[model samples]
Target chain A: MSAVTYETEALTGRDFPERAREELRDSQLRGNIRKATTTIRAKTAEVTGELPDWQDLRRAGQAIKREAMRDLARNLEALEANVSRAGGKVHWARDAAEARWIITNLAQAAGAEMVIKVKSMTTDEIGLNPALAAAGIRPIETDLADMIVQLGHDTPSHILVPAIHKNRAEIREIFMRAMGLDHLGDQPTELTAAARRYLRERFLSAEVAISGGNFGIADTGTICVLESEGNGRMCLSLPRVLITLLGIEKVLPRFEDLEVFLQLLPRASTGERMNPYTNLWTGVREGDGPQEFHLVLLDNGRSRILADPVARETLHCIRCSRCLNVCPVYERTGGHAYNSMYQGPIGAILTPQLRGFAEAGSLPYASTLCGACFEACPVRINIPQILIHLRGEVVREKQATLGGRLGAENLAMQGALAMFEYPALMGLAQRLGRVGQKAVERDGRIDWLPPGLSGWTASRDMPALPPQSFRAWWRSRRGRP
Target chain B: MSGAREAILGSVRRATERMPTGVVELPGYRRALGLDPAALLDRFAERLKDYDVTVLRVPEAQIATTASARIAERGIRTLLIPPEFPEAWRPSGPTLVPDSGQGARELNEIGGVMAGCCVGIAESGTIVLDAGPGQGRRALTLLPDYFLCVVLARQVVGLLPEAMPRLRPAIDAGRPLTFVSGPSATADIELNRVRGVHGPRTLDVILAG
Candidate 1:
């Protein structure tokens, strides 16, 4: 990779643990995340639980995604052809820089000084707004949460609700200060009205609009965007030129396949039975929305992920954020802890693979292996298993870098391995541990430890070594020699 | 750029070729939904109502009267209707504006818009609007503050699977299709839903028997 590309894409380099530690100190942030996640989680469970055939729908979703990823080349070719036949241009982006270059060039070619955007995670992943700003073009976020985030000069903290970390008061403060509105109340209706009035002018005046596709149907060359707010629809409808940045994995084989995903995404993301609006458009028409259309298929690290047998399930993610809501770790530290465009359990597994182990190696260890994410996943991605797999990769990478020299962790593992191999040593160690426990024991628990081992006891107490080893007790009960 | 496309496709092909993906059976999905025709229409109306969308169930003869009442109730002045909209269903007293490729500026000035839906799904309270005769361009339905959609009983389907095949013709013609569940809304602020964002703030559905 070019140094320029590396420098640009390495935007999120703060380690997960450090960021999480800092985030845990914020009580207000924690309460906001807790309330938002609790509400969404309950609603999600209610709606998804109502479906008697939910498991069937999940399986179908998984199967459809797998088929699409497996046969992506053919489907993409078909999509390009269909889109071209319908009067839209398709561009191929090998990486983040290329995608940004293509989109920026498109905007410049259209002579658009500014563009209005729908909430798109892919664009955020590519750092498109910064890139656009660098090219002397302004990109306005029309989604209420995204607008709040942008106005506050903050990054998005959640997939579904970008400003879930901020409450209504914080939002009102943002509007009062930044939006030139004074005496704004902290009610949701007033906040939404302020955002609506602010964004309506931009929507009407915007010459070009950029969005992310939820599903790209190769059968009809259609791009589908599902949203609760009308901002996406406005961006899709008002602008004369529409540019959609889509991850290559989003394509489906047919329009019929949306049946499964349409059922799965809304419930999993926002816990709505159905979002307010679902916009599906194929290319351009003479006098309809977006007379000029472009679709940039981005593969910023997805193909590398698709190559892995055990880890390929990451591609099946629908960006639902259910895993984020249900994740205990996410509930505590929230999205900022992960330090990537993606967050929570899915982020723990996905971010490492997308950004590579060297940059995001610590992400896989962010999870507690609670398996809540797996259950919450609409496509049933085995996130805990992937986390363990990526942890192994990180360990192996470190070992290879060290040229086989044992690190402290490896030395500790070697000691444990030796003890496991020798029964007499194991017995001796257990007996010694009981005696050693007296120094640290307090009320039958060990609360603190030395530097290297303190992380274990930091959040939880370790039970003091038993007075009698199980093997010794067994031997005494059985009257063994 | 073509080179990039070739390389990417090559990588995908090589990657997928190594893994053995098994064929999956759909497993009686349609049978599991178990929706009846009349019940489906009622379910559709009920679901849309949950989103605060007004659903007016009237006999075919009362479409004009009910539509006019809804428009009058909303106090809408200028109304935009598709050129191919049935004259019998067009409400009186409001100055009728034809949707003849009106830009966002022109459309935004109108108070309300009325269109016909291609199909309605009961399972997910959705109305699909393909840019056809009765459904003008997408801008008309979107720019106005209030929207009234006309849905026939026959257009209602039990589930999405039953609805997709019917749109095959529209899909083949590459018409821009929009599936609207309710008026524009946001749950972004504290996860509390507030209606009326950029699309029509009010959605009134007239279900013609």
Candidate 2:
């Protein structure tokens, strides 16, 4: 059997802690993220609260996704057959490398010098832009936020709003520098108009366009792409050839399921009743949309994730990104700290699993276990539970190595277990801790700690140990009575 | 490539071997807003207005006059009209260009496009275009700066679920669908929404009975 290859480009060079430490220093990024998250959170609450059956809709979505994952192989085969029957070619990719190669070859075969792109996280996961650029095909991002990120040579920091880290002023600078404008205002109207003018010509002449699937119906061979701007429509309509890169897990059993998701997604993701446009095409239409269509089914470690029963629910995400807005850690540190295209609470669990624990093991520990992400999830994914589950997997993998068995953390945990087993030993340790903490104590809190224990105190203050242990206090009180 | 397909399917089968499988029933929640037909139309118009789209309610006979007035008001001179578009609703003054697989550049040069819709959802204030008789192709309404869609009162539904059954026939016929809730918009700049981007910036909907 050939070994499975996990996604590589989505992994980060540095661990989450190190990346977070650097991100915390940028007060401007912090301010921008806080404001954006706050605005989106309010909007989502207002719109979601309007639905009397919102909870029922979420539950139905969860059940449907669970069933889809359970019968994934059969559904995928069905999807392929239906798409082919409707005149669309279906390609299967085991991993990112294969997907990229297939897409690059297709673009080359079509003699495309430039290809327009709709905003897609799947393409970013496989690192498609660099592959296309290497093949000498210019890929133009037509989404306003994606264009801002591409023009500035920056990675996306948020799922819904890729340029969430940048305010209008920064966007203005990036647009002016990239578009070669002498003067550009920072107002959103001016910036959007500039993008429309810049991308209109590209859309008119592009031969090929690429997008990520929001949902692919297995029964009818329908592919859905939902967006706020008309960029998605332009790409889906104008291009002669349309290529959609869909994860294997994005398939739904029936077309009517859109009723549940269409209601949930827009409200949860962008806090709108409905986005400006949603494009759905089955395959090649004679004179309407793309004459040639290709659907690339990408596994890229999704099957490996599905193997584990506890963590498999991660596949149920609709990319609504409400979790990112509600998460305390994501709000304070921003998405750059997560070091993956899938950021915030979802990223913490998803990246580690998709890229393997060895490459992204530190991501599971990036959260505060706040439980906000679980409540905010549209499909009812138990994210905090999955975080704990992934953390166990990370620890178990580490313990398999000799270095991990004898590591400082393992020894400390063993020693603490022994101390807790004996009351006298526990008392002695508490007294010693009280004495040791006095040196770093300030205003009844430990503001600093020695190197081994400093990780906790770096971002927070630990309350000073009480004068007497709780056990001792209870004993003394009983004696006095 | 076939080997990759087999490998992926094999792994998925192995991964899900232990998981339980059964029929997952969809919820039985109410599909409609439970409003009268008049209220549904009012709700639809209100929702569209929230997105800053201009909405006009006209009698069936006055659709042409109202649409023509809207076109002249917006100063649209040249219009792209699908051949299947109802002759009764065709405006008088503008030079109507029939859709003949026009390139994007040519479509952009035209002032606006007018079409009929398949269904309208009041809950989301959305209209679905299924390349049906009068709707023409997807690009006809997409590239132009202005779009005027005529939605008969009978076409409006109370909710998304209600609209689904109406769209199934179009799906079975292999037609492409576009759902437009409003004009093109973006909130990418610090979550401040600015309408008008790649799609038509100005949207006028004639709600006729």
Candidate 3:
């Protein structure tokens, strides 16, 4: 029932800058990203402004998440006890491979040939579909966006709308080619109709179902999933056997903590006060839902993140993707530029910590330190500060590998320190620098520079040695010299 | 799996070694609207109407007549109802489909489902069904295209905080619950909203006194 080969996301050899350069060239992708983000950004501002106590809500959200992290062990124990008392089986997985093995065994135990799924970012992060496919169990995506992505044989680009990179025409073509249909127009409603017809039978007949929890309450051992389309209800209700995979960080201390996240997530993600469907189930019920329930609690590098006091807040993300909508870099390059399942500012900080700092060094530098992500964050994560901390960690690691010192960077810092130590030497160098730039100056700016320093000049011109340096002009004006 | 659980829990315990096992004060949205029953009903109806869910308010005596009219007007040929539903509330127009542990395919063939809600949230316009009494099983209300729910005015709660305590019994009993705010809708394709996906495409509320 279990196999060693699970299809997780493969790492591209290319870094963010390389992928961003390619994404930037596609004007159609750029237009799609910009239009979608602009609409969501405006709508979020309007809806979030209606509540006068939004700041209080944000603060409360942060506090509750902090409390959960502070006492995760106790809450987890309570959750396990409650789930056991309610007759649901619990399994723990240390990484993605172990998680896949557990879920595959469950599906096989139930004699399931195919499984239905709701839209869950955790499953995407662990690459659950490909694994299930490899084990000869077909996993069908029931969400509208996920169905589109699965049919198109593409990866998800955005968190909320995974197929945001594709327009309606592309979706129609995917439906026609994949589902073997014709005469479909480019209207979203028509394409949705096609999906509804295609997936309805599967939803009714699928023997097993898999989902990722939005919030897990420790006290009641209840799992909450919020979704707009009724696919979530279908997946949660119709199947005979159910399996849910959740990250360890999704636990809340109490069942009532849902009010805060329920307020924060929908408004931030889709600009709605509440989504259409919010499903909560404690465990296996006799005649109602699935007869058997299994929960797989996945670590997958979260404990390492929890150990870091400086970077721990990255775990508080509710996967809202609000930061993505407000991000200029994400707006221009789109989610595909990030080269990971998680994208945008939240992804920039979270991906590195989850995968480890050494493997994802370039992710920290992906941001412009614009502070918009922090401002838009529902939990007030202070993402910029975390990025800076990760940057320092990367720099320190690199320096250690370079025999305790970086070559050019070390020499430049030493030179600056030496200059700052002597006022006369600094003044003399400033004068010499003014004279030194004459060879490269073109219309008072240097558009090209020497080797090793050409990266700055490649993007924009550098002001050629500002006439005299501010200190020199200040001294001259005051006649202090 | 046992080894994995121990390893995971060990790592978590080590990571949170500095945490104290005491009562931690957490900031939360503690505001609960203290509205009277009538005001709460009005607010709940308004909120439900805001989501494009039709809300019809009538006296308790008129519930049977109104439900019959609604079933006829909506052209519902077969309506599904739980075994515990009030005999008086059954409409005279449509053929009532009994809750006989029907499968998804059978439920899908039904025209509509009418159930009694356990609670109504005023702030979010939500109707919660706990699979108790006349609510039937989860699949009955989910597979059908149209859902008509009856919510007594007294069952309306002002906020989520006020509602959760009332829902504790169902939560503890591990009953399957559904929180339906409006008809099934999606903004997946280019963030444009299109209604009627997998769940019921139409939701009508009978706010009876």
Tell me the whole-model lDDT of each prediction, alpha carbons only. Answer: 0.87, 0.91, 0.86
Best-fitting candidate, scored by DockQ:
2
Estimate the TM-score of every prediction: 0.95, 0.95, 0.94
> In candidate 3 chain A, what residue range of length 10 has the lowest lDDT sum?
A1-10
The superposed Cα distance between candidate 1 and the true structure at residue A447, in angstroms, equals: 3.4
Rank candidates by lDDT, best first: 2, 1, 3
Over A1-481, each residue of candidate 3 has an lDDT whose tens digit, in order, gives: 1121212223545677878899999999999999999999998897688766788789989989989998888888888888878889999999988998899989989999999998888887777888888888998888998888888888778888889999988999999998898689888888888888999999989999999998889999998999988999999988999899989999998877887788788888888767899999988888888888999999999988889888888999999999999999999999887767788998889887777655566889998999999999999999999999998887677677664376787677668989999998899888998898888998888998888988779888988888878888888789554
Model 1 over residues A268-330: C-alpha lDDT tens digits? 888888888898888887777888999999999998899998899999999999999999999
List ranges where model 2 is wrong by over 4 Å: A1-13, A420-448, A461-481
> What clash count goes with each model?
0, 0, 0
Better of 2 and 3 by DockQ: 2
Chain B TM-score against the true chain B, each candidate = 0.94, 0.97, 0.96
lDDT per residue as tens, model 2, A1-481:
1111233322535677777889999999999999999999999999999999988889989988999999899999999998999999999999999999999999999999999999999998888998888889988898998998899888888989989999889999989989999988989999999999899889999999999999999999999999989999989988899999999999998899899999999999999999999989998888888889999999999999999999999999999999999999999889887778899999998998887877788889988998999998989999999999999888888888999889998888878989999999999999998998888888888888889988778879889988899988898899574
TM-scores of chain A in all candidate models:
0.92, 0.92, 0.93
Q: What is the C-alpha RMSD of each candidate to the true structure, in Å?
A: 2.9, 3.4, 3.0
Fraction of the native A-B contacts that model 1 recovers: 0.78
